[model samples]
Target: MSPATCVFYGCRHPVERGMSKCSHHRNRAPCSALQCHNQAYARGRCVRHGARKKCPIPGCTSYRRASGLCLGHTATHSAQAKARHLNLPPSTQPNTTPPAATEAVDAEWVLGLEPMDFKLPPSPSWNALDSVDLAIIHILLQDTVA
Candidate 1:
């Protein structure tokens, strides 16, 4: 049986028996598994063929993502490193709940919107949140209040 053709457009090159793309089109490393035609996911072999390098520490199934340990270990390691470098123990989590409104109104209030012909709100705001974001926030506030 003939090997599959290259997946690239306008290319008629014949792909090798254990390769997906032709030599000209292939960019990533081929799977280390014998006769496997898939791309390498990590640690040499294809994803399905045990590509992830297991953590050196036992009882851990997660593969090594960053540093010498697996992903789960990396998070705690990062926390430890941060605390050690800063010379401070990890602080309590910051306040997350929004402040409750102090005043309670007897009557229901309605929010009204003025029509914009199709333009972003006035600018000169922070670069991260553009004028368009202000327009959207206005709409969202109107929705929640109503």
Candidate 2:
């Protein structure tokens, strides 16, 4: 029998024995690797050409950050944003200096009181009494003069 031919348009290359198409015209799955033409592994690239998620920034090899940029790019963008917000050139911005320290005052003096000299009024003992006793007391007091 005549050799099987490639089904693709304008291609007359003979197919391999017991196969559908010639080596060049065969429906070989491509690797996930950029511009790679090797057969795929289960529709993905092989281990030698494993796919990886990279930062969106061009030529950056670092892993992606929350904003799709690498860590270094993210920091650069943040600094640019801060500079824009302050309406100043990043290079011309003043250095941050620590604030001056102030004297500390006693907590008691701040509240206008002398500790241990002031005493709170004693708590009422009625809260300790039973509900029945309170009811009896209320009835007795209501029946008596003011």
lDDT by candidate, in order shown: 0.62, 0.60
- Give model 1's TM-score versus the native structure: 0.36
1-146 in candidate 1: lDDT tens per residue? Answer: 96688754345789866886788767767677777766677887777789868887779887777688876677566556545644664474222232134433212111123433443334343458788998999999999776
Cα TM-score per model: 0.36, 0.29
**Which window of 10 residues has the lowest lDDT sum in candidate 2?**
97-106
Itemize residue pairs with steric clashes in candidate 2. Answer: none
Best by TM-score: 1
Error of 1 at 43 (Å): 7.8
Cα RMSD of all models vs. native, in order, equals: 17.4, 28.8
What is candidate 2's lDDT per residue for 14-64, written digit by digit as tens? 977777657885765556777654555653764347543567778888876
How many residue pairs clash (N, CA or C atoms closer than 3 angstroms) in each of the candidate models, in the order given?
0, 0
